[model samples]
Target: MDIATYTAFCLTAGPLTILMVIGLWKLFEKAGRPGWESLIPVYNVYIILKISGRPWWLLLLLLIPGINIIIGVGVAVDFIKSYGKFKISQNAAIILLPFICLPKWGFDKNTRYLGPSATISFHEKHRKDLQKSTTREWAEAVIFAVVAATLIRSLFIEAYTIPTPSMESSLLVGDFLFVSKINYGARLPITPVAFPFAHHTMPIIGGKAYWNGIKLPYFRLPGLGDIKKGDVVVFNFPMDADSPFYRPVDKRENYIKRCQGTPGDTLSLLNAKVYVNDEAAITPSHGEMEYMVRNDGSSFNRQLARDLHLSDIQQFTNQDFMMNMTAQSAALLKQQAGIKSVRPNIRFNGVYDPEVFPHNPKFRWNVDNLGPIIIPKKGWTVKLDSLTLPIYRRAIEVYEQNKLQVNDNHISINGKPADSYTFKLNYYWMMGDNRHNSEDSRFWGFVPEDHIVGKALFVWMSWDAETHKIRWSRVMRMIK
Candidate 1:
C-alpha cells in the first residue's frame, strides 16, 4: 500500500514497539536489575549498553550524523551476544524491528521471567515477559496518537496563518485556522524523490522538477457551488504555482472580495453597488458574530470577519443605489473641491448618471459594493462572438483554454487559436464566508475542479490575527 494508506499500520507499530521494549525490560528486571532503569532516557541507553556489554562512550555515536551507522552496526553485533536464549543477530533485529520478537519467542528456549510467555519468539511471548505493561501500553498509545496527528495534519487539513492585511477585517492578518482537503477528497500518495515525510502527492510537495515530471491520473470529487458574491474565499495563488518557492497565499497575503458574480451569472458594476440579475444584492450575513449567551454562551455567523479599513472605500454609504449619476452630477463631483476626478474603467466612463449613484450603497471597488458580472460554467456553451473579455472567457483560458494543433492550423484561447479544443476538466469558484475580505474567485478566476482537494467543514480552534493570540472564545466552535 502507499505510504498514506499505511498510516494505520505505522501507528499500530508504536504500541507493539513499546510493548516489546517493556517486555524485554521486565526480562532484564527478572535478572535482578531495577525495573525503573527502563524509564529513564539516558539511563535506559546505559542499561542497553550494559546489556550489550558495550562501553558507555559508544552511546555518543548516536549524536553523530553518519557516524551512527557504523556504531549502530556494532551495537547490533554486540547486542546479539548479550543473551544466549535470544540468538538472533542484533543487526537482523535492527533491520527488522517489526519481527524482532520472533527470535525471542521461536528461537529462544529460555522462559521469560516477568510477563506470561508461551514460546521463545516475541510472537509466542505473553504478558509474563513484560514489566510494567501499562507503561508500555500508555507509551505506545501516546506515541501512536502523536504520529497520527502529525501525519493527518501534514497530509490532510493544515493550519494556515494570515500574515497580511489583504484579507483584513474578515480573516485578520494573524488569524489562525485550518483548511481541510478531505471534505472534497484526497490525492493518492506519491513517494518522494528525497525525504520520507514528503509523502503528499500535491505538486507543492514534489518540488519543481519533481512536480513537473509527475503525471496524475485524475481522481475527482463533485464540484461544489461557485463562491457567491460577497463570500470570503481562500485558494492557491495562481502565479505562485509556477514559482519554485510557492506557498499558499494567507488570508492576509491575498485579496478577499465578495463574490460579486458566479458562473453563468451575469455581473456588472453599475455605479458600484453589486447587481445580480438586475437586482440589489444582499449581505445575509457578513460573518459569524461572537456573542455571550445568557449567563452561558452562544454564537452566530460562525464565519470569520471584522469591520476594518475596508468599509470606507466608497462615499454615500447611506444609500444602497447604483450610480444615480448624470452629466450634472459628474460635473458637480468633478467641480467639488478635494474630490478626485471620476476615474472608472473605460467601459463604464460617463455611464454613471449624475442623477444616479452607481448600483446602490453608493458604488465602490471594495468587496462590499462591486460587480454584476457572470462567471462561466461547464456543460454550458456560448458561441464565440457572445463571449467577451474579463468574464466567462477569462475563466476558460485559465485551465481549459490550453493549446493544441488541429491538422495544420495553430490556435490559442483568449488570443491565439489552436487546432482542437478539449475541455479536459471543469473549474470552480471558492470563497470564504467573510464577504468583505477574502481572496477568492474574483482574483484567481476559478478553481479548476481537478485541483479541488476538499471542503472546510469545522473550526476546531481560532487564533487572533493581529496579536497572534489564541482566542479561547472560539474553541470548540463549529464552522458554518
Candidate 2:
C-alpha cells in the first residue's frame, strides 16, 4: 500500500486492533471477564469502561470531535487506576505508549491485577521502576513528546511570529502570536510525513522538510466557528499554485491579514478604503496609510519619527516626505512646527497595474480602486464569460481542482462546455492594515477556505529589533 493508504489504515484499524487483542485480552482475564470479549471492537470498549469504573454513557463523549481526545485521556487515566497502578509515571506511560504499558501491565508475572477496591499502596512497588529510565525508555519518551506536540500543534494552537510589516500596527513584525486552530477548524496536513517541528524548509541547511511521495486530500475537523469579516486570519499563500514547486496548501508560506470580504460578500476598494457589500467597512483601529508630507524645504524630524516609532519613513524629495502613519500619528506629525501639509497618498482610479489580480489590461484596476467582485461561497455558481472568467479562473482551475480551458469566446471545464461553475470551496478576500506596503488578496486573489490556518489569538512575546529590547506593553496583548 502507498504511504497515505498505509497511514490511514494504521490510524483506523492497525495499532488499535492489536491493542484491543493484547492489552485488553490479558486485562479482561485479570478483571474476571471473558478474554474473547476483547476481540470485539465496540464490546471491548464497554468491557474496558466497566473495568475502569466509568459509566458506559461516557462513550458518547468519545464521539465528539475534539472532545474525544480528552475522553480518551480520561479513559486511560481510569484504566491505569483500575490496575492499581496509581503512580503519575504509570499514568503518563499509559497515555504516551498504551501499547507497551497496557501489555506490560497485563502480562507481566510480577504485576498483579488489583480490583477497583485496590489501595494506592499497590503502586508503591512500581514507582522505583518508573524512576529508573533505560535507553529504550528515554528513546520512547522523546518519540512520545514529538508525536504529542505535533498533534497538539496541528489541531489546537500554533506559535507564529510576524516576519514582515504587512500587518503593521495591527500585528507587528516582531510580535510572537499564538494562532488558534480551532477557531476556523484545523486543516489536516496534506503532506503528513514530514520532519518534526519544521515547516516547509529546514532552517540554515535549507532543504524541503516534507516527503511528497504521499499526498492526502484537504480535510478539516469541525471547528467552533467559521471565519468572519474584520477578523484577522492566517492562511496559506494561494499564488503558489503553479508547478515546479507545487506546495501543498498547509506547506505554503503563512500570511496574516484582515478578512475584508467573506464568502458571498461583494468587495471593492475605493481610494484605499475597503467596502463590503456596498457599505464602507470599518478599518482596523490602528491601521496605517501612506501620506505625502510636504516639509519646509528641509529634512523631516527624524528624531520625532523615531520617538513615535515610525521606522518606515522616507524622504521622497528635499521638501516632500513619504511616510506610513496611522491617523493618530499623522495628526501628531501635522502639528509639528516645520511640517507644511500631510495628505494621504491615494492612487488615482482607472489606473491599471500589471501586478494586480486578474493581471489583464482590460480590468484597469489598481490596489486602491479595484474589485467590486463577489467572493465565492461553496455551492454558489457564477457564469463564465470573458469578464467573469479572469476574476475566478484561478479559484476554479487551481483551488477547486477543475480543468479549465478557454478557446476564443468559449469556456469549457472538465472536457465539457460549461457557461457557469459552482465553487467547491468558500473564498475570502484578505487585506493588510499597512494598505500601501502590503501585498494581499487584492494582488493575488481570493484565499480558499482550505488554505486557512487559524485565527491570530495573542502576542505572547514581542521584540523590537531596532531597539534591541523586548516590547513590554505588547507582550500578552490579545489580538483584535
Candidate 3:
C-alpha cells in the first residue's frame, strides 16, 4: 500500500472503529448490557441493532451489494435515537461524522443513554405524536435522503449521461446509463467531502465541487469480477494526470470507453483493427465506422436517416455523401434506392497524427496505426531507452508518483541512475467504438488501473437531443 492509501485507512476505518467501540461500550453499559460487547465487530452491530428497536436479522442486509448502504444509515439513525438524541444536526452528524458524534454522545457527562426504560417508550410515543416541529421533521427527512443517495451513488451504482459520441452506436450520446461500481468493486472516495449530486463542477456556478481539506486514502472493495478485454468501462481521464490542481481519482472527469488491452498484453492497431497479443480483437456487433458514400443525384431520405440514427452526414457533392455509420446502418443505406456505393473511410498506415499518445515527434503513430506497445503490469520491469521512454514516461512519473528525469543517454528515477523500472500499478488501453471520431488512448496514453471507475451496465434512458424526443426503444436496454 502507498502512503496516501495508508493515511486514508487510518483516518476513516481505524478511528471510526475505535470511536464506535468506545461509544457503544458506554451506551451498552447504560442499557444494562456488557460494555465489552461493543468491542466485538459483527456482534457489536447485532447488539446495536437490538438496542435500536430493529430486528437482528436485518444485519444480513449488510451483505447485499446495494442494499448495505441503506442498512448502514438506518442502523445509524437507530443508534442515535437509542440515546434519545433527536435533533436534526445531531442526526446529520451521526450520518456524516459518526466518529465524532458517537464518541461525543457516549463519553459526554450530560448525554445520558435513555434506552430500555419507561422514558424510552415515552420518548418514542412523543416523537410519533407530532412532538417534534414540522420543519425539523422535513429537514431530517431530507438529510437522510441525501445521505442514503450519496452512499448508493458512491458504493453501488451511479446514473451517468453520455455527453459525447465517443462510444457511438454501442453507447450513444444522450444515453443515460447506470454505471455499476460493484462489477469491478466500488472505489473508495479519495475526496470524501464534496457537494451532493454535483460531480467535479457545480451546476451554473462553474467551480470545483469538492474541497481539498481532507483527502481520504484510495481503496476498493472486493469486486464481483476483474476487468476483461472488450468490456465497456468507465474511467477517469488520464490526461488530467498532469494537472497542476489536485484532482482525486474519483473527482476527475468520467470517461466511458472499451478496454482494448489489459495489463501484460501487447496492443496494436493495424489498419483500424485492434490486435491484442497478436490476435484480432472481436469488435462489437453494432460498432460504427465512417464511410464515404455515393448516391445517384438524390438526397438521402430524412425518415430513413433518423431511423438509422445517423448524425454525422456531410455532402461533398450532389452525388457523394460522407457519413459516419454502423456496418448494419451502412448495409441498410446500400439497399436504398439511387445509392451508388458505400465504402468505409480508412486512414492509411504510416500517416502520423501529431496529437497521438506521448505526442513525441519521433513517433509517427496515428490512430489506426498505433503500437505493438506492451501495456505495463504491476511488478513488470522493462529496460528504458529513447524508444520506450516516451511511451511509459507519464505512467512512471505521474500515475506511479515518481520523480523521473531523462539525462544524457541515461534515465534517473528519484535521482538514481536506472536503466529499467518496474511499474507499481497495472495499466489499460481504452478506445471508443466510434473508431474514426474519438479522442481516446490513441490521443492520450495508457489508463492507469487507479483511474478505472466502473463497468457500464444499462441504458436506463436515452434522449434524441437533435430531434428533442425520447428514444423509447433504448429505455432499460442492457449494455452488452
Candidate 4:
C-alpha cells in the first residue's frame, strides 16, 4: 500500500479501535479480571473466551481466517448473556454496537457479572424459558448456515460461471470455476450488508440486493502472492462507475481476464503480439483470435468447422471467410483441401480506433497495435499535461475519488493548482485472450487495485449448452 492509502486507513480505524479497547477494559474489571488484560492482543481473546465459559481450545479457532468471524460472534453473544442481557435487541447491541453497549453495561450501577453463560448449570436453571419450538430451532439452523456460507464465499473461494466468449478457448462459456480469494488476498466486502449469494440484484424480485447506506473502506488480508503477468483474474467492472449506472466498487459486475501487464511495466501490442517492457510476453497456448481465410470458391465444410472449434464464422464472399480459432487450429485448417491462405486479421499501426483506451486522435492506437504506455504504480507521480491527462484523468478523478479540472491550459486537483499527480493505488492492464471479441482494458483503461476480486483457480465443472451435454475432459481442469 502507498503512504496515502495507509494514512487514510489508520485515520478511520484508530478511533474505532480505541473505543473498543476502553469498553473491553471496563468489562474486564467488572468480571474481576485486570482491566489491563483488554490492552493485550491474543491474550484479550483468551480472556473473552474464559469469561464466556468457552473452552480454552476455542482460542485456536480464533486464529483462523473465515472461521474466526463465526467463533468471535458466538463468544460475544455468550459474554453478553453472562451480564444478564437476554433480549434479541440486547444481543444485537453487543455484537453491532460493542463500543457503546459494552461500556454502557459495564459502567451501569445495576449491571453485575452473573456466572458464565455457557456453563451447564446456568443453562439448566434457565431451561424453562430457553425452550425453543421446532420452527424456531429450524430458523436458527438456517440462519447459521447462511452466515457460514457467506463467510466462506467472501473470504476463501467463490463459484463463478463464464457468461461470455471473451476468454474463449482458454476458459469457455458455461465453465463453472472455483475462484481463489486467498491467492491474491481476500478483499473484505466494501458493501457488507447484502443479500446472501446475490451479487448486486435480488432474485425473483428486481431490486438492489445490497444496502448502500453503510460503506466500508477497502481492505484486504495478506495473500499467498501478488498478481503476476498471465494470471487469470476476476475483477469488478470499472465502467459501472459512469453516469446512469453508479454502482459501488464491490457491487459492480464481475469480469474475468488475463493479466497482461503488472504495475510499473510498460506494455504494448504490435501485430497482435503482447510485449512487456520491450520483451515478448508469454501468450496463452489455447488463446484464439480472428483469422481471414480464402478458399477456391468451393463450398465450406460444416464438419471441419465443428471439428476445429471455429466460432463466429462469417463468409464475405464464396472465396473469402473470417473465423475465430487458435493458431494450432488455423495451421490444421491451412492444410485442408480448397483452402488458399489463412492469415491473422491484424489492424495496421497508425489506424485510429475511437473505441480503444484514451480515445485520442493523437495516439492512433487500436486493439492489435496499442501503447508502449506505462502501467501506474503506487506512489508513481506523472506530470499532468494535455497529452497525459487523457490517459490518466479517469483513474485520478473517478477511481481515486479526486476533484480534477483543466482550465486555460492549467491543471487543478482538489481545487488546488497542480502540475503533477501521484497515484494512490497500483494499476494493472488486463486483456482478453479472444482479442477480436473482448471489451477489456484495451477499450476502458486501467483497473485499480480496489476493483480486483480474486484469482481464477480452476474449472470445477464445464457444460456445453449448444450440445446440451457436459464437457467431461474440461471438468476439474486447472486454469493456466
Q: Which numbered prediction scores highest in TM-score against the true structure?
A: 4
After superposition, the stretches of candidate 4 with alpha carbons farther than 4 Å from their true spots are 1-19, 39-42, 55-64, 84-92, 107-111, 117-119
Residue-by-residue lDDT tens digits, candidate 1, 50-79: 766678898897665334544665564454
**Pairs that collide, model 4:** none
In candidate 2, what are the lDDT values of residues 1-480, reduced to their tens digit?
Answer: 225556786686677658747977898888899989988877888877888777999888888776677678878778777777765578778875787887877887766666654544544655665564587678768866886788789989999999999888888889999999898788878888789999889888999999988777677989989888888999999876667668877788888999999989998998988888899999898888788888899766778987665656777678987888888888888899988898998999999999998899979899899978999999899998989998999888888777899888888898999999988788999999989889998789999988999999999999998889999999999998
Q: Tens digits of per-residue lDDT for model 3 on 86-108?
A: 66677678877877877777788
Local error of candidate 1 at residue 132 (angstroms): 16
Candidate number that wins on TM-score, 1 or 3: 3
- Once superposed on the true structure, which residue ranges of model 3 sit more than 4 Å away at CA? 7-38, 50-59, 63-66, 117-120, 124-130, 244-246, 294-310, 315-321, 332-341
Evaluate model 3: give its lDDT.
0.84
Error of 1 at 396 (Å): 4.7
Candidate 4 local lDDT, 1-480, one digit each (tens): 545767877887788788888878888888999999999999998898888888999888888776777788888888878778876678778877887887788778787778785346656888987898898788778877887788888889999999999998999999999999889888998888888899988999878999998777888887889999999999999999987768899999999999999999999999899999999999899999999999999999999999999999999999999999999999999999999999999999989999999999988999999998989999899999988899999999999988898889999998999999999899999999998999899999999999999999999999999999999999999999
lDDT of 2: 0.84
| Cα lDDT over the full model 4 | 0.90
In order, what lDDT does every prediction score? 0.43, 0.84, 0.84, 0.90
Model 2 spans > 4 angstroms off: 1-44, 47-60, 70-134
TM-score of 1: 0.44
